[model samples]
Target: MKITVIGTGYVGLVAGACFADIGNEVWCVDVDQTKIDKLKQGIIPIYEKGLEPIVNKNFQEGRLHFSTNLLDGFDQSQFIFIAVGTPSNPDGSVDLKYVYAVAEEIAKNLKDYKLIINKSTVPVGTGKQLRDFIDQKIKERGINVDFDIVSNPEFLREGNAIEDFMNPDRVIIGTESIRAKEQMNELYSGLFKDAEPRIIFMDVRSAEVTKYASNSMLATKISFINEISNLCEKVDANVEMVRLGVGADKRIGYSFISPGIGYGGSCFPKDVKAIINTGNEYGYDMKLLKAVELINETQKAHLFDKIQNYFDNKKDGLKGKTIAIWGLAFKPETDDMRESPSQVIIRKLVEGGTKIKAHDPEAQNEAKRLFKDIETSIEYFDDNYECLKDCDALALLTEWNIYKQPNFQLIKKHLKNPIIFDGRNQYRPSEMKEMGFDYFSIGR
Candidate 1:
């Protein structure tokens, strides 16, 4: 199959690479000439594990290509995938400007019958809106062409995107047309070659809702665990143990139950807000999701409170403190820092007149961009131990492996005070107490 994936963002790039790896000729089209050129030279713009090698290999093998010319991609492809970004509006509705713009462009240049897949995470009924928009444009131009809109939302997470794309839990196709279904089945033939891949067929609206509902449920789980972790701190219980006990239940099974500062990344925050806003538009409020959102917001502030409380109750009150942060990325294994809880914690700490030194394995450059305004107030360290030197205390904001089991002896020798505020619960409180250091963590 010859496929054209539009927009070249995270989802687009990953999907294009994975499709090409499965023996399809994929043209990853982007409006940004710079991005297209970089990709053409095998310079990937994003940081995803196992993506660069696959994309580069496929490009070298002549299975993948990049282009800024939409007509070139359109003319050579039988399937067009719209994998653009749908950033959330302030009101929580998904911004459809990019989706609409791509649809209009495709309508203008589409030559023959093509299966247009909505691979972007869009709102319910967006397929109908796109169908209507394309049809109106085609009629206005008095051009006779045929195209079918199929909703095929992606469920790839940031860190493990490559594996997820290759071995999807399920592939969704939202179309009633038998011809469209057969074409999609053929496109996904690689996955079904070993065993029959589950093909879910539904109306386009239901298909769109599945993407939001799936992400929103995962986000809700993260918030629920964080909320429970907060309560565990008040009740003198360990969240890790509780998680183990609860997760042992066959129904609960542990996936998104890890307690942390908060959930962040490109998908969860935006999708939860968008779904809540969708409910609001129908004259119904999503009270539970509202609580979930509030809990997550407050959880991000919890780390700041822990640091402040530790200071105030102790001899000092952060008057002349230098805190070292272990991780700056929203989560481990990705360079993405969008909506990172560490950003909020670091900004609040700096605002309170404390100096911060932070280090992440891969997110330092990305973090530097967001913290440019406070560049003078913070220091970016190449080595995790470098940040630990001469600091009053250490805060583990991310669960990077280097920070998991560190040289406590070295840390005690370097810091002015051996105080640790672990946001990710990377350390056991009993062990820290035995080490003769003041330690704090989520839950216990």
Candidate 2:
């Protein structure tokens, strides 16, 4: 199968690379010439585990192609994937200009039958809208061509996108046409050959809703656990123990129930907001999700509150304090910092006259760019221990694997005091007490 993936963003690039790796010729088209140039030379922009090797391999084997011209892919492939970004608007609605623009361009260039599959996360009924838009555009040009729209929302986790793509538990494809289903099945058959993958066929609207509902549910679980963690602190209980006890339930099986400062990533925040806005537009109240969103927003400040209260009362509060942050990325194995909790915490700390010394395995570059406005108040370090040097205390934000079991001796020797504020609950509180260090962790 020959496929074209437009907009070489995270979803598009990963899908294109994985498609090519599966023995399909894939052309990844983007408008950014600089990005296309870099991809051609095997210079990946984003960091993901096991993505670079696959991309480079497929590109070197001539199965994968990178080009700035949309026509390059448009001319070669019958399956065209709309993988552009649908970022959130100020009112929380998904901005569909990118997807619509791509569709119009495809319509203008349409001369034959093509399967226009959507890999971007979009609101429900987007397939119909695009179908109508393309039809109108094509009629305006006085050319008749056949094109079918298919909604195939992505469920790729940022850190593990490649693995998710290769071993998807289920692939939800929405198209009423048997022709569309048959063609899509052919394209994905090889990818699902070894596994018992469920390729569900449903109506387009239902398929679109699945993506938002899935992300919102995961976000709810996270916020529910964080809310419970906050209560645990008041009731003198440990969230980790509660999580263990609660997760033992066969139905509730632990996944996104880890109590943390908050859930921050490109998908969760955006999807949750979009769904809530969708509900509002339809005159329905998403009451539960509203609470979930509120909980998450407040939870972003929980760790910072712990830091402030730990130093403020008898001391100068957060003013004139230097805090060392162990991680800056939303989660490990990727450098994406969009909607990162570190942003809210670090910004507030900087506003209060406190300095931040941060270190992450891969996110320092992104963090530097994100916090450039406050560059004077923050210092990034190559070494985690070096970041703690001369700082008042240590705060762990992201749970990168390396920070789980760190050099405690070095942490103690480097910081001004043997104090640690852990947000991810990476360490056992009992052990911190035994090690002669003042440790503060959530829900403990």
Candidate 3:
């Protein structure tokens, strides 16, 4: 199958590479000439695990190609996937400019019957709107052609996008056309041959709603656990133990139960807001989701307050303090900093005139670009422990493995004070106390 994936962003690049790796001829279309040129030279823009090698192999084998010209991609492919970003607008609606632009371009260049798949997470009824827009445009041009618009939203998480794509738990196809369904199933059958990932079939609107609902559920679990963790701390209980007790029930299960600063990435924040906006448009309120959003916001701020309150009624005490941040990425294994709690925590500390020495196994350089304005305020370290040297205290913002079971002896020896604030609950409070280090964690 010849497939063209428009918008070579995180989702597009990973989908394109994986499709090509599975023997489909893929042409990745992006408007950015520089990005396409770099990709042509084996340069990948994003830092996703196992992506570069797969992309290189596919390109070398003539299975994958990169292009800046949409027409070239359109002319050579039977299936066109719009994998562009639909960022959240100020009103919480998904900004569909990029997706619409790609759809319009595909409409203009429709030479034959093609299967148009929407792989970007979009609002319900977007597929119908896109189909109408394309059909109307083609009619205006006096060209009678047929194309099937199918909703196939992606559920890949960052830092593990390749693995998720290669071994998805399920494949969803939302289309009314039987021909389109057959073609879609054929496209993915080879990928899930033996594992037999369940292929879910539904209406287009249901498929769109599924993506938002899935992320919203995950976000709700995070906020729910965080709320419980807060209560556990107040009542002198351990959230980890509570999580273990509840997760033992086969019905409850135990994923996304860790009490963290908050959930942040490209998906959850935007999708929750978008779904809330959708409810508002339909004259119904998503009260629980609204609370979930509020909880996440409060969780991000709580980390800041924890550090300030630890200083305990002392003004300007943090002014000259040097704090070491162990992780800067939103999570481990990816360099994405979008909506990262590290941003909020670091920004607050910097405002209080505290110097910061941050280190991540892979996100250091990305952090440099993110905090470009703070020239004299922050320093990046390649070695995680090196950041602890001469620092007043350490803040574990993201749970990177190197910082998990560290040489506590070295940390105690190097820091100006043996104090640590762990936002991720990566360390045990009782053990840190026994080690003679002042420790603060989310909920025990």
Candidate 4:
């Protein structure tokens, strides 16, 4: 199987590397020459666990190749995957310029019959739109080149992308052409040989919607739990106990139910907005999704309010206070800070005339870049304990593994006040009270 994956972003790069690892000759094509060059030299752009080693091994073994030229890969490739980014517009709609541009480029270079797969997360009916666009371009060129478009959206979590790819819960292939389906089955035959057949074939539109709906549902769960946590706080109920009771039901197995500041990262926020906008475009309003978005936005500020209230009770407020922030990334095991709740909390804290000392094992440089405007108001520390030194209170935002169990005695030694606001519920309230520290968390 000779395949060409356009775009070297998370999805494209992971798919290309994994395909090559499964004995397929893969050409990872990118428009950026510098990115292609770096990839060729074993320099990966992103930090996905278990990705670099596979890419390096496959490249060295002559199974994987990198190039800036899109046309170069078309010569021997049977499948061309468009894995470009669909960034969210200000109006909550997806910007499909990159997707359309890739379609036009592929149309111009088509030499023979090829299976064009949309590996990017796109709105419903985008597969048909791309197919129509390519057909129009081919007709204008007076060429008889044939191609079939299939929507094969990816479902890889950021930190566990490689594991998800190699052992996918299910593989979706969307197309009506039997020939195209047979070819895809053949290409993936080796990878699914030992596993129970988990290939799901569907219409192109359904496949496109599946990606958005799946992500939005997960986001909904997070927001729903956060909302319940807020209610629990008002009613003097412990969200942790409520979560345990609710999640004990087999129908609602405990995933994404943990009450946190909010759901953030590249996918959930954009996908929720995009889906809502998609609904509006079709004369339907996604009321539930809109509420989900609103709740998530409110939840991001929940921790900041707690910090302010804590200081307000002490007759000082956040003004002139130095707060220690543990974790800058949206979640742990990755450096992505896009739409991170920590960003929202930090920005609000800075607006209240507070100084911040933040630390994350992997996101320190990223945090520095994100908070450059507030450089005078915040400081980044290489060590977690160093960030806590002389701070009034410690705010645990991202639930990194290292922050789960820490040197509490040392934390008590550094902070001017023995106060902790845990956004991720990393510590038990009873234990914190026993240890003689003021601990605040989501809900109870």
* Best lDDT among the predictions, by candidate number: 4
TM-scores of the candidates in the order shown: 0.97, 0.98, 0.97, 0.98
Total colliding residue pairs, candidate 1: 0
How would you order the candidates by lDDT, starting with the best? 4, 2, 3, 1
Cα lDDT, model 2, residue 313: 67
Number of the top-ranking candidate, with TM-score as the measure: 2
What's the true lDDT of residue 101 in model 2? 85
Q: Candidate 4, residues 1-444: lDDT per residue as tens digits? A: 899999988899999999999999999999889889899899988778899999999999998999988877787999999999999999999999999999999989898999999998899989889988999999999988888999898998988899899888888888999999998888767677854377888889999999999999999999999999999999999999999999999999899999999999989999999999999999998999999999999999999999999899989788999999999889998888999999999999999999999889888888888889999999989889988999999999999999999999999999998999999999999999999999999999
Per-residue lDDT of 199-253 in model 2, one digit per residue for the tens? 8889899999999999999999999999999999999998999999999999998
Better of 1 and 3 by lDDT: 3
lDDT of 4: 0.92
Worst 10 residues of 3 by lDDT: 309-318
Q: Which residue runs does candidate 1 get wrong by more than 4 Å? A: none
RMSD to truth, every model: 1.3, 1.0, 1.3, 1.2
Name the better of 2 and 3 by lDDT: 2
TM-score of 4: 0.98
lDDT of each: 0.89, 0.92, 0.91, 0.92
